[model samples]
Target: MRFSISSDRLKEALSKVSAVVPSKTTLPILQDILFELKGNALYLTATDLEISVRMTIEPVDGEEDGAGAIPEDKLTSVVKALPEGLLLKFESLDSNRVLITTNKGGEYKMSIEPADSFPAIPESIGETAGFGVVISGGVLKEIIENTVFATSKEELRPATMGVLFQFKGDEFIAVATDGYRLVKIARRGVVNLKGGADFSGVIVPAKTLQIIAKSIEDEETCEIMINEKHIQFSTERITIISRLIDEKYPNYESVIPYENNKELVVERDLFLSTVKRVSIFANSTTNQIKFKLDPSGFVEVSAEDVDFGGSAKERLDCAYNSEPMEIAFNAKFITDILGHIDSEKVLFKFGSPTRAAIVQPYEDSEDREMLMLVMPMRLNA
Candidate 1:
């Protein structure tokens, strides 16, 4: 089999698909990328079993329809050295060797496994059904950045590794948390799919979604096709497929307390900045920070490390509507959740000192559709 394509176009396509190649591959074939050449288009594919991304590029000229697997690392290295606009040709001169010669007067021959030896990808698409969800690339990135940080890094609870995508009426919500803090964002006017595995509450691994989100950053809208076990994101030139986390996500609704007796409205930036500053003195093991609020409309933030004489306290004017209350929370959880709150003013809803506290945007307007829940820490005070 022999095929020739422009090095520039080939490299661009390979750059996108090669992300799926594993950094530490168990199987040698998993480290290579499958290249398929058709009449005028070239298909590039990479997979680590958990996720697969495929991209297509059209060459300036189509030589022969052929397919092969090339060592991704070596192939990328070789292509990067070739001059722009130079043509690179791939021909199976031997069963185990492929020759790559460029128009730029450089020659390189590399040993490679045959394309036929590559493991089979689920290319059939399995009678999949898709949704016509339309979300701006900016919106998608914003939600991911705000919530993905809260996803648990530990693998013991698989559901915590993913962001939950749920559809309710006209609202499309994406939520993620690591048990200490939770973020829920609702995007109205996003399409809700039917006729397929409507992946509601389906935990999509945060890592996989981040990769797919980056691939389609330039497109205004993207389609998500879902089957029983896999989810696919299709762009005009790229397709990313990822396995779904089968475990059931925790009932997040229950975790969010509705009747929090205390409420404080504060400047978002000031509150977040204070948390960052006070957290520096928090105990290393617990990272516990305290908030003292009174009906007087001001709050004192403080933290202390008894072992080292570390303590900090700050005061800020706030809008308090209920009786005085004090609460203790993990500084990291507070900072992590605060980073995602995008509003000039934010509302802190609190109940008893031991109960969870809810943080939300100041107003119920549709502009900022997010609600965060932060579990409080057991405190001595």
Candidate 2:
């Protein structure tokens, strides 16, 4: 088959789905993108077995319909380097070679493989009808941004390596935890698809959500479908199908402390900067940073590395209403929580230095809520 499309447009579509293609796969064909020309549209698909993304783009000019697998790196490199707005010609030649020619007389050829070599996109399990939910892209992006950072990288506990999506009534919560830090984002008044209200929970890999977040545009709404094993996200330009983590997420709510009576409100930027600066001197092994909350609205932050004879300290004014207290925390953990807060000010609720502390945005929104919990470290001093 032969087809012609804009180089820039083709590059953009390929980039969107290319993240699913593993750089090095046991099956060499997995490194190539499956391309097919059907009717007036050109379809592109990429997969790593566990996750697949397919995109359809209509060609500006075309001839016969055809399908083949083109080396992803070759196609992406040539298209991206070509001058924008140039029409690119793709034609299948003898001996499984595909010729890519530019409008300016530039030509390139690469070997292709049968499109059938690509694995088929998975379908929902038999006897199980799928359920779906309709949510705005912006809202979905917010949920991922708030929680994905806390997902565990450990492979042994596969559940903790993904973000948990739990649906209850009209609200849905997204939770992620790496054992040391937990992030939960709750959104209310979401529209549930037909037969979707009864759906309980699903764990989505953090990598999948990260790709979805990058592909979606603001103000766009996407349809999310979940079955027993596979979850799908469909938007205007692309559709992503990924296997669910297939593991039960921990009962994260139980771990949150209820007796965080002490509250300290501090400027988010100031606190974040202080933690980052002080962390440079923290022991590389423990990353321990000390926080001394004063009743006079000042917080003393200090860190020391006995091994390297390095030390750092800073004091910042804060709004503290609770009793005087001192807490020790991993400096990296403190900065991570502070970085995710969008508000100008953040509130920290603490019951004791040994208990998990909750961090929240000082300003509350009606439709959404975000809470982060960080486990403290033991002070060396």
Candidate 3:
């Protein structure tokens, strides 16, 4: 392949596609990026078996139409180190090699592999085969950020390693949990279906959601296509395809408690800060901290490290009229849940010390709702 593109443009495209390229693979070919030049547009593709990314760069000076694979690390390093405004030319040479030359009179040659050796890229699901949905990039990004962190990192529960995307009529819900904590966010009328089609749900890998979240622009719209086994996300110039988690997700709805009448409203910043400060004295192994709530509108946050003989306690005023109760929880988990809440105040509902506690923002918009659940830890006798 032969083409000329500005160094800055090429660098930007490479940064996006190279995210999926495997750094160390048994198959060396997977480390290279496939480059295809046609007319005045260039296509770059990279995959790591589970996920694939393809991006298109147009308006390049295409001298010839061909395809080749170049080492992703080498190409990216060269482009990034070169001057931003310099035009970089790529040309294939004899003996399976490619030459890269810059307008500043710098040249570099790297071994290239024929495009045929690369794995077959997944084709887009056509209109007749599967359903497609369009969502605002900002909305999608927010949904992913709000839930992806709660996904399980353990391999035993494959389903929990990804976020669940449930579609019910026009309501879109994203859920993630790691057994100890769960995040569920629902948005109404956010998913614009291309046709009159509905599906139950799909488990999307957390890595895929994270990549899409970083790639999409707030002003742009993202097109999503789903089939039985795979899912695809596409924007104007970039496309990403990932294999769906085949395991069935646990019924998360059953775990959410609706009968928790005990409610405590506290300043998010104050509670979060107190928890963090007290956590310093928490047992390193359990990271356990205790919350003693009083009907008098005050809550005590305390932690003790038995081994180190360290202890801390702080009292924060809150809005709670429930009977006095004490609950224990992992300080780290509480911090994570509180950090994601964007509101000034946070709401906590408790059924009992043994039952899971629900955390939410003090206010929710008409179109969106977010709920997070954190299981309570056992207190010392």
Tell me the spans in candidate 2 whose CA falls farther than 4 Å from its real position. 122-129
TM per candidate comes to 0.87, 0.96, 0.96
Collision pairs in model 3: none
lDDT string, candidate 1, 142-202, tens digits: 7778778889988999899999877665566888989988899887765555622233656
Q: Candidate 3 at residue 246, lDDT?
A: 96
lDDT (10s digit) by residue, model 2, range 175-229? 9999999998989977887644666789999999999998887788888888888
Reference-based TM-score, model 3: 0.96
Considering summed lDDT, which 10 consecutive residues are worst modelled in model 3?
Answer: 122-131
Model 2: worst 10 consecutive residues (lDDT sum):
122-131
Model 2: residue 236 alpha-carbon error in angstroms: 1.8
Worst lDDT 10-window in candidate 1: 190-199
Ranking by lDDT: 3, 2, 1
Q: What lDDT score goes with residue 35 in model 1?
A: 77
Better by TM-score, candidate 3 or 1? 3
- Arranged by TM-score with the best first, the candidates are 3, 2, 1
